[model samples]
Target chain A: MRHILRETWSGLKRNRAMAFAVMVTMWVSLSLFGVSVLVAEQVDVMKGRWYDKIEISVFLCTKVHGGATDLSANTCEPGQETTPAQRELIQTRLEANPDVQEVLYESKGERFADFQEAYKNSPIKDTFTAEDMQDSFRIKLKDPEQYEGVMNEAVTLPGVQAVQDLHQVLDPLFAALNALVWGARGLAALLIFAAAVQIANTIKLSAFTRRKELGIMRLVGASNSYITLPFVLESLAAAVGAIICSGLTVAALVKFVVIDRAKPFIDTLAWIGWDAAWVAILWIAVTGVALGVIPPLLSTRRYLNV
Target chain B: MITFDDVTAVYPGQPQPALHRVNAEIEKGEFVFLIGSSGSGKSTFMRLIRHEQRPTSGKVYVAGKVLSNLRQWKVPEFRRQIGTVFQDFRLLPGKTVFENVAFAMQVLGKRTSEIKEAVPEVLELVGLTGLEGRRPDEMSGGEQQRVAIARAIINRPKILLADEPTGNLDPATSVGIMRLLDRINRRGATVVMATHDANVVDQMRRRVIELVQGELVRDQQRGVYGAE
Candidate 1:
């Protein structure tokens, strides 16, 4: 062990600059991977928490001759009006369902009020008045998986015309975010792999340049492990240095870049915060070691040519 | 004792075998000169003893271990028992003379005290006792070669293989290096040196094994360098 360490120490000291260069390269590459993985995980967690709380919206039919009828004129009989009593019945039924976690009743006037606030300056806001909207029951299910069951039950209700899960409503937004996350992960992996290869090649070339010295060591009775240990250790040392730098960079980006820029949105978001910092830290450290070990193992094996 | 039983070596990317059907043996404490012109397989023979290249079709037994049949892991252990020096005086350029000599023992995992004890003793034997702290660049060619010798013998190997040890030195310096190797041989370590220097070889009057065009041409006890 001492022999191996002595060899490692000598090698590192001999090419201190090259070692440092390799390390810096590893740090930047690995930091990008670490940060991206953490952000994706955090995004997933946010999706889980928020999607669990989302409500399923059930649109009520129009009232006709003391009964409910489909709101669209094309689907409705001659004269139909969606009544308050029909909406009340639907809301009560949704509230009593086994899968229903809660039910929120929204009257046409309330829907109009929300719409006016949602699109205050839009031209379409004045075109459709509060009375033109259908009364709806927003039902929160116990789990997101129960959404289909709840939607089926809701659409079959006496006064219901249609039911929609909000995820389907926000599908475009979720899809865009998911695509961004996966794209970032793919890009990060590619860059990190390139960096690892770069590091391996650099170390390999260094070994080749010093083949004469290594041959001398061998002729002079230096053990095989002793000759190999320095190259391995040099790679590891550079990796460690790079990993540390990458970790710090990741932490800094998370703190100053992501969190700072997203502060307003994050503050209003009910359940996202710094709880993922430890997980990020763990990922960074693991990435550093893996990046350090894998390439060196390959490069040294080739360098040894045994 | 080292013996070659009809050993032949063919290196890759070469047109022909470097050594061909060579048979010889050197008993313990024998100081022998391996004489040949360049490309006459002198270096190849040296490498075979060190197991750098295995014999293509025959056996090479060094101190009872067959070099051709040795496994990869056993190679380093095998080399540790046989010291080797090269023509270029392969000293670590960045290391001090003491460190270079101490390195041999260090690789064998000898304790610090053992290194502290052994390195100085070997340096004294090589006549580089006071130049221990100097790097290779700071020393003369002869001094660097002495450092290489000290490194080779520090582990107290049973056999010392010198491939053109004085090929790059002046006659005076070459004689000095030869005498040091001779002294080590006298102390019971077998010395096998490959050289073309007729003056040193003739003066030593040791056993000689000569090779020509990859074949053994002569083997003479009390041999002269150019006796062919």
Candidate 2:
């Protein structure tokens, strides 16, 4: 072990420039990967936090009688009054559904009031007065999974117009985030592959430079395994150095940037536990060992000749 | 302790064998010179003993082991028992003279305690004690050759093969290298030096083997370096 260390140290010193280059390559690639994965994780946390409190908006329609051009729209359609009795009956039916955790009834006037507050200064505000809006039920479900069942039942009601699931509203954002994660992973893979090739080339040149020395060593009773141990250790040292640089960079990023800024959202998601830190460490450590070892095994093939 | 029994070596993409029908024997402590003109098989025969190239036919044995049957894993061990010094002085430019010599012991995984003691001792044996810290480029042609010699014998190998060890040096430097080989041989290691330097070859008056083309033309005891 000591001999291997000595040999590895000498090799690293002899090719200090190459060692630094590999270090920087590893640092940059892993750093980029670290930040990207953390960002995706944070976005997921935010999604989870927002999903729990969000409600589904289900719109209902009134009967069309004498078409008064829908004037006094705040009032029910002409001869199509939805009396208190009719409203109570709809409420009773919704409350009886198994998936319905809670149902809140909001009249068109209330929706219009909420809209007025939501879009206070928009020009479209003038076009959409409360009277032009539909009366709706704001529904909550026992489980997020039951949303589709509840939505399907609500939309088929006699006066219902639409049942909007809030999760669907966030689907596009989640999909975009998923795509970003995959894209980052792909780019990281390409860069790591290039780094491996670079490492192999570096080892090849190292072998070429020491061919005669290797020949002499072989002659002087050094076993093939003994001679190979040094080169393998050297390659691994460079790779491990790169890995350490990358791992530290990743851990630091997670600590200083990701956790610090996303704490509010992260705290809201209970399942996204602190075990993520351990996983990151293990992943980076494994990546480092892999980067260090694989190239040496391959490059040793060519160097074994001389 | 080396013998060649009709050994022949044929290189790829060549019209003729590099070494053909060669037979010779050297005792354990013999000092022999392999002399020939350019394109002769002097270097090829040296390579055969070192197991750098196997004989294409017949048998080649070193220290009682049939080299032809030795596995690849055993080649390094075989080589370690024999020392080879090239004409080019292939000292690693980055290492100091001491480190270069110590590298031989290091690769053998010798203890650091052993290396520290052995390196300086060998450097001193080659008349390079105080110059241990200098890189190869910092030394003269003669000095670098001496360091190469020091490296060769660092492990106290059984045989030492020097192929044109002084090819790049002046006559004075070449003579100095010859004396070093002589000193090593006196320490009980067999020495096989391949050279074109007739002066050094004739002056040594040791056993001389001559090669012409791919054949052994002469093998003489107490020989002179001439065509007689």
Candidate 3:
């Protein structure tokens, strides 16, 4: 066993160039794999934040629907604009529900101010007045997925003009983020495949170089595992070295790049924590070792057939 | 210890068989010489016993086990009981003499104590004592061959094969190597040597098996070279 390890170590040292090539490829692939894990975790954190904060905004009657003078098709209905009685009754019903966590009421003036801030430096800023705007009840649910039941009940309420979910506003963004995560993972898969191939190539070279020794080993009654062990160990060592390197690279990425440098760009995003980083490192390292062992184990089959 | 019953080996991509309808048997404690011209199936015969090549037409039995029916995975265990030496010395180029000899035992999963004991004993037997640190490139042809011999015999295999073991040696060194083989045979191991050296064959006058164009043309007990 000592000889096998020593042989692998010396062979790796002797073929430093080849070993370096294999290590470089492994490092790049595993780091990208790490990056993809981080990206997925970051997206999930952001999704959780957004989902937790999402509310069903039930808008009251606006000027266009409530300001009509006539009592015809264009006229205001008896309860077109929300009255105190209607709002009190609906608020009582919402508060009575088990899934309703909290409900916040926003007056027209407050909504107008928010519109002004949202449309700041734009031509549509002062064109809208508080009187013309609609008031709303932002309904927070115990579970974000339980919004549908609230929306169904709130839509039929008196003076409720529209039922708007914050999830609608954020769905496209999450979709785009998911696409990016899958893209990163796809590229990682290809790079890891290239790494596997490069490992096989380097192992084949090592096997070919040590073939003379292998023949002698075979004739001397060396077991098949003993014959293929050096090559497998060389590959595994290189892979493990690269895995640790890539793990460090990922740690630096999460610590220095994501949480630090990407803060301003990702201001609203919930930064991925160190727990996720460590998980990614552990996952990539284990995967890298397995990936490293498989290729050479296959490639050295014929060489050890002696 | 060995039997080739009408064995014929035909390699792929070659029309003519390497050995056709050949038969021979070698008993234990026998030192037999296989004499043939180049391509006369002498190497094939060695490969047959080594299980490197399966006979195309017949069965080969060694120690009562059939070679052709040998399972692929079990070949190593079978070869473990046999020692093979070649003309090129086949010593690992960069390893020291001690490492070269110890390698034979090491590959077989020998205990460290076993290697530590047996390597020196075999090295001493091959007259490689105190030169254990010398690499193959630093040694002469004879020293290199002796290291190969030491490695081959460290297992004390039941059968020792020498395919022109002294093909590249001086007359004096050849005589010495032959004496070593004779001593090994006298110790009750079967030794089958294939050689083209007329002087060594006639001089030893051991059991001789001759092949001509893949045909077993001669088998004589205590025979000289080419004696009908």
Candidate 4:
């Protein structure tokens, strides 16, 4: 056991440059892997926070006074007003829909107040008043993804001027975030492959340099495992160093980037915490150790041959 | 004891066999000299005995075990019973004489007490007692070869195979190494040495096996270097 340790130390020292290269490669790759995992977790958290609050708005036809023509009108005819009986019929139909979880009547005054608050800093708020706003039914769906069916049926309702699904506004943003997740994951995979190749090269070079000592060991009746243990240990040591580096990098990213910077600015969405970072780090550590140990074990078996 | 029954060894990618249909045997407690010119298969003979190479067609029996049938994992354990020495004196350049000798026993997973006891005794036998602290570069060529011999015999192997053990030594130093090998032979281990030196061969007056172009041309009891 002592001899194996001594051999491993000397082997690592002799190939310190290549060992450092292996560690750097593994560290960078594992860090990228952890970041990708965290990004995926962040996407999931954003989905959970935003999808639960998504609503569908059904705009009722409104009266236009003095024969005014609204060129931007959708389902509403120019100068047409929805009667109270038509409004009640529209609400009754919406409530009967199985996909609708809840229906709340929103008056024009309430919509106008919300519009004013949302565009408080814009000059556009001056041209909009309670009379210009459309009265609507704001709906919560059993599943946000089922908005298409509810939206289609609401457009066909008697007094509905237009049907708007809020989730449409969030689709592009989620698409971009999902793309980033896959991009990071793909890049991490490529870098991990490069790290494995580098590890194999380092082990082969170390074995070549120590061929003489290995030959002597074989002649002295040293077992194959005895000859291979040092190289495996050297690779495992490099992997351990990379695991620590990547774990700390992932933790710092979660703390500084997500928790410290993003969470406060985007307070509406819940961000991933240290637990997610730890989960990512655990994955990176497992991958790092596999990359560190398996390649050297296989390479030494090929190159040493004794 | 070793026996070669019509053994033929052909290295990969080479059309010519290194050893072709050669047969010989040497009993225990015997010191035999393998004398041949370069490429006469002397080194291949030593490699066969040490289980480094298997016979291409025939069988090589060492101490009652057929070497061709030895499994890969058992090769190390099988080799512990047969010590090997090379012409270049394959010692670790940075290690002291004692460490080099002790390394042999260490590879076999011998206990510290056993290694601590046997290393000194083997060094004394090889006449390297006072030079235990000196590294290989600090020693003369003869001393380096003595360290190699000491390492080989430290495990008390049943057979010691030396391939041109004194190839790099001067004539006077070669005699000193031959004397040390003769002392080892007298200690009940079979010794097989391959050499090109005619003086050592003629002076030793031991069993000689001569190979000419991968074929055994002569096997004589109490033979000299040449046919005459």
As for candidate 3, its clashing pairs are none
lDDT digits (tens) for residues B1-228 of candidate 4: 899999999999988899999999999999999999999999899889888788899999999999888988898888888888889998999899989999887777788899989988988898988899999999999999999999999988999998998899999999999999999899999999999999999999999999988999999999999997
RMSD over all Cα atoms, model 3: 4.6
Best by lDDT: 4
Encode model 1's per-residue lDDT on B73-184: one tens digit a residue: 7777778788888888877787899888887777667899988988888888888878888999998888888888888888889999998999899999999998999999
Query: Candidate 1 — which pairs collide?
Result: A62-A82, A63-A81, A63-A82
- Chain B alone, candidate 2, TM-score of 0.98
Q: Which candidate leads in DockQ?
A: 3
Interface RMSD of each: 2.4, 2.1, 1.1, 1.4
Superposed model 1: Cα runs more than 4 Å off? A1-20, A64-139, A145-160, A208-212, A257-261, A270-272, B133-142, B170-173, B226-228
DockQ of each: 0.45, 0.45, 0.59, 0.54
| Cα lDDT, model 3, residue A247 | 94
RMSD to true structure for each model, in Å: 4.6, 7.0, 4.6, 4.3
TM-score of 3: 0.83
TM-score of 1: 0.81
lDDT of 3 by residue, A1-306 (tens): 887877888998999999888988899999999999999999998889889989888777655766543221122244467777877877887777788999889999998899999999999887878887878888899998777788778767766767788877788999999999999999999999988988888888888888888888888778888888888888888888899899999999888887778876768767887888998999898879987899999898986564
Candidate 2 lDDT, B1-228, residue by residue in tens = 999999888899998888889999999999998988988998889888888777899898899999889988777777778888888998889899988888888887788899999988888889997998999999999999999899889888899999999888999998888898999999999999899888898889999999998899899998988966
Worst 10 residues of 3 chain B by lDDT: B219-228
lDDT ranking of the models: 4, 3, 1, 2
